[model samples]
Target chain A: MKKMNNRSDVAVKYLLISKDGNALMEIGEKSAGIEKQIKIDGYDIETIVGFPNIEKKEQIVDGIAKIIELLKNGEKIFNDDVLIEYVDMIINEKSIDEILYFTLKHIISSNLAEKTAFFILNDKLLKLRGVVYLKRDNEDIIFENRAIKSCQIDLSNRGKIADAMFFDKVVTVNYSELPGKNIERYFDKNTIIIPVYNIKGVVGVVLLEDDGTKAKDDASLRLVSRLVSLGINYSSITKQLKLSKEDVAYFKESIEVSSTLTHMGKITASVAHEIKNPLVSIGGFAKRLERYVSDERGLSYLKIIQSETTRLEQIVNDILTYSKIFNIKREKVSLYSLLMDLEEFFKDELMIKRIMVKINCPEDLIAYIDPRKFKQIFVNLIKNSIQSIENDGEITIDVERVKNGINIIIRDTGDGFPIEIIQRPFEPFVTTKEAGTGLGLSICHKIVSAHQGQIWLDNYDDGAMVKIFIPSEGEV
Target chain B: MKVKKILIVDDEPNVARLYEDYLKDYGFEVKSINNPHEATNEFYMFQPDLVLLDVNMPDKDGLTVLRELKKVSPNVPVYLLTAHDEYKRNFNALYAEEYILKSRDPKIIVNLIEKIKE
Candidate 1:
């Protein structure tokens, strides 16, 4: 048994064997040539035996046996060709794992003297992905269960083929010369090693053993290289496809949110228009009635109408302000002045309601923000806190500078938000107040989000706190 | 003495009637029409000195009627009425002589009518 590189060499050598054995030889590339020659040889051999009466019976038996042997040999050759063909198809199809499994099965069925297995290079961890036995009887079971079955070699050995993959190197283990404990039980007494390489790195190694003369061959090594290259390319393409899908999903979600915000703006404008007219009418009529009425009782009623009208006007203005998309007119805004403005604006209202308003913002605190939008945010939060109190409640506005940003917290003495609303209070049209349009916190959320800040509601043991955190101007 | 008759046009009868009653109290003879289609007939009969027109109408938009009134009596001052500030800004760009928000107090309306007389 000698290592043969080409099919022609193997066929020629087979003919030489038949002739040397003193047998009548007939070998052709086609199956018919062999069949015809075998029949002629059977008849001639029977005549030479001098059994003319039994020649027909002997010839029939001998021809049948020769034909059966030829067919069996032909079928084995066909199977090898088909296996190679299947490996080529899988490579062309770019099925990495399938090619590995098929190649392993082919190596096992070929019954080469050596025990063989495949190993993939793990670039990230710089190690071998380890022995993928293609021809084990329980290959499917081990693959599914992910446990090493019945191989005496310890896979955890640091100096094995897997470790060599880290340095993009190949290790050839000749079992007859150096029988290492790492893979002694798996291989024959004689072994030869071959390395497989791709553009990225050394991919794997082939293990072979000598029976007599049929040992390691170049054709087998070349096939291994082709399989490794296809495997790497296929894996890369699959990874790219997965990333592209994620990006598409992100883009679709962004588009949906933008459309919803646009619709919200339109609704805000319409509501503002409807509410303003009636508010004006109420305000105007109350002023007129107040001026004409002489009774104190009539005056008080007029005052109540005037106060309510003012509240309605505030709500309309807030909705209009919040619903409009923020185009930050960035400027150096003094945080202290902004807070002071809010304090002054709410001073009279808080006094009237007997709600104490406290501020703890630093005088030197400043940020680059649209002053108008910033003012609106503060006014909304403060007004919300003031409105939350039923009677004799206090509101606190605190601003503090953190390492990378500023944090503003507005807490109220009134009862905290309902548990359900606390989780999603910033969603548009979600309100607990009977008169609220539920756009207050939503607007705050949008404004803060535009500034790349965060807004959240915190429920304390005593009351509710609304906190806003905005990155420092220079930091952003 | 000839009194200047101002025509108040609005879809809401209450709003139109309120302006009419208030304008009359301020010594301006006023006629009102809630139907936008009846605006042409009322304007022709009254020959209003100034027209207070609501921009949002059921049958005709205020700007369209403003153009029609201008064609009939170009010199008669047409004040376009809007309920929103954004609309007020838009009306400022139109050819109308004045734009007043419907939310303006009745006193402001009376003041504007007196100023037009002056």
Candidate 2:
């Protein structure tokens, strides 16, 4: 009898016990120079001498026992018919994680391989999607390792797994010849890499680290690959179906919102038109009576009436504007000249606040826009900045041309929006000022959206900041 | 320069009266018509140097009445007035002298008339 001193001796065979399972009858051994031979030949030995059985002393024992019993009855563990039935039962009812967990546990408990790992292939990138290993403490099976979950196998370099994926066939390489650090980290000697295929050809690969006893039959390994490929395909199809459903739901919602806006627009225009007639009457009479009034208090009352009516008229006009449909007229206009025009228009307001305006934009930077409509966005934002600043502050308009669009950032050196209003600044009727109609930002949002653009607000550096992105191509 | 007679046409009687009072105090001979159907008849009778025509009216479309007024007095400067600027785009092609938003102070009409380059 050999001394059982060599590492390969203990690795390939185990202690054979009597039927009573109380004593070891003999130490099993195999030919020493069989390294070059396929490990599949070892499966011919029917006795459980060299195989490791489930030793977990917990409720998990029943699951392991059932898998071992099925194998003992001469049923091939990788049989596609049996696996499809089992996979079908749990596939739809369980999450991908749970499915992977059950499949991995079945693989290990049936003694198909000592340890296994599943990799999801995306083109040349192999992501370590899931892994299963036996715990050394109680020999309980485990599914995922958080530390190794993000590990990726790049197929650019030559390795057994990459070779199997690229060649679309099975690859067997010794642990030392694994070709990459990540491959060497997860696998042991005599590791087999089998490519999993779908209708689209090879989609993934499985790494089986066998204990030198199981048959490495090509037919059985291919079947295992087919089974796993089915699971991957099912997961992907279900994910796409879920996304399609969500897209349909979103489409329905947008249609309903657009219809509601159209209805609201009609009502607002009619109401604004009706309110304007009364406003003209009240405002016109107030001015007429001011000339005939004598007392100082009477004069002040008349002034209030006139000013409040003007304010009411302004509110009505804003409502009409907000609900108005935008017929975008696209034009190629220089943004610099537009800002300069606004600065000139608001010269008096800017001067009164002692505000310094600095615009950082290319004089030649042109954007496709409706000049009249685009001007309204800047006018509202700049005016807000002016009103926010109490006295003597800087307002900066920084513009950059992006690949698909233009980016504009407006920053004001003033106290930012109040916290409550900042969260929903673009919503109608949200304002911090007492006299504000609160439709300013909403109108800006509407116009920017009409131009296939986006707008958002933030607070930083002791001021309020507004960022806007307008796509270069207008949706005319 | 005589009084630079101004004709005001609007559907609202009170609004028309208000403008008549303000423009009369500003030393302009102002006559207002509350009905659009009566506008062209008044324009011929009043023989005003300028016209302040409201865009929206109950009896008829102000743009149609504008065409009638232009036919008779093509040389006269007619300003389109409205509570909203929706009609601004149409005013230019119709050859109106200016577009006045009714939201403005009525005194603006006086100021615009005072600056007439007749």
Candidate 3:
């Protein structure tokens, strides 16, 4: 593979890998010169960590001198031989961030450079968020600052730093010392700025102080970039996985809370049933006493007792109904007979209001239903229709046979249901009337549901149109 | 004509007495037993034509008592009464002639039992 040119204008030769971490081709960067294929067999990376440079044929004498000195102690040792073992040791150490820190530290220490700063892009803002700077003072290697206060390197061609990053290639901007160039201001006189690319695009820049020698330290520069890229990718993935794990925990907690709410609902239903028993006993005894009380004052007081107890009874019934433990007795009934009886039952009110009642049903339409419960469904619906008419309104009841069931439609020539509550009319305590219990539709809905049937309001502009479907067969 | 006899078994003493009072007023010989264990004994002694059994009770529930009572007198009619609709609504109440909730007005219950007598 062709290695990045150490003689590039940038402080370091940057080889851009794809931002997604796939291809090693830098996006916009042109290596200052044609790439030279790496002579891997000539220079082993391990050699620089311990022994003198042996890749330079001119340094053969120095390499030999180092070997002879080790041999004088009855050993022939070479750093190149230990390259595999040392790389494994450095990787085995966990805390990859620290590994990258020390890996870069080791590279700078070996190359004998004065300063280095690693800059990684914040993809969201398209700016450098991290500036990992290190310094070497005599024998002490100090990590002076990893945070940059004003580290906004624009990903544009405004300066050399922006140009190298935006172009997705490394450019070594040469200067005797730190220049006014945006990225150059952070480095020493001789700096090498390299581009670090993730799999898909250029992500950051890595700048190292060049030793200012006639011949640059090309061997070590080539390897440092590889180690630094690997470290950055590892840190990004770990952070994302941690955030995802927290999201999963929050999801599980909501499920637990909802389950608890369901349990509480069951308990409340049973408690309401118990309360109804005493309420019944209280109301029953009060009514039985009304017959004995003959005075006007006593009778008027008894009337209050009678009305309030009935209202309280209805609320208990609603709670029990929601709990869903009620039973029904099924019997075959003709739909025509039920409607005729309902008409007769409401004859007085219809005559007084001068409202016409129309029934459209076949004589033989019959189904097995709990007569009382089925009657309640129609009564609740018809009563609401009657109340809606301001004057001589008409109610039309239509029944037709449909698939596996009967469809009953009650259309009234009155003001249609208010648009605000039309969508969910069956919800408990939803009513337009001031004196309504607000559970009429909910009760009707419950009765239909218990019969394993569907009931809904058919849209109409002039009047309210209700549609009901009950299976002809008994589910029991 | 011989007057019909009715036996009532309930866990609550007040409720049992309440039924006894209403049944006596309906022109029937009425007996109330609060304990399920004593219910069988009362059944044999009173030899009631009708049995009004509470669905839930101490020691033995109404279902258990019904099974025991039926084993002794399989032909007699037994009605189940419950404080709530849940027990009466359950299909476990299949053996009962009728299951009624105690939450209703007492006069309705009296009228229902009178019809069962005929």
Which candidate number has the best TM-score?
A: 2
Best-to-worst order by TM-score is 2, 1, 3
Error of 3 at A280 (Å): 3.3
| Candidate 3 lDDT over residue span B43-108, tens digit each | 998899888999877478787787668667866778898876656433225456777777676676
Go through the candidates in order and give each one's C-alpha lDDT. 0.60, 0.68, 0.63
lDDT of 2 by residue, A209-276 (tens): 86688776665566566556555554554555567768789978786566666677688779878999
TM-score of each: 0.48, 0.49, 0.43
The lDDT leader among the candidates is 2
The CA root-mean-square deviation of candidate 1, after full C-alpha superposition on the true structure, stands at 31.7
Error of 3 at A404 (Å): 13
DockQ of each model against the real complex? Answer: 0.04, 0.13, 0.04
Worst 10 residues of 3 chain A by lDDT: A44-53
Question: Interface Cα RMSD for candidate 2?
Answer: 27.4
**Candidate 3 CAPRI level:** incorrect
Question: Candidate 2: where is the Cα deviation over 4 Å?
Answer: A1-258, A474-476, B1-8, B26-31, B38-52, B66-80, B88-100, B104-118
Judged by DockQ cut-offs, is candidate 2 incorrect, acceptable, medium or high? incorrect
Q: Write the per-residue lDDT of candidate 3 for residues A33-84, one digit (tens) a residue.
A: 4333222223221111111222221232233222223323322121332322
Off by over 4 Å in 3: A1-268, A307-345, A360-376, A398-409, A413-420, A432-437, A443-476, B1-7, B24-51, B69-79, B83-118
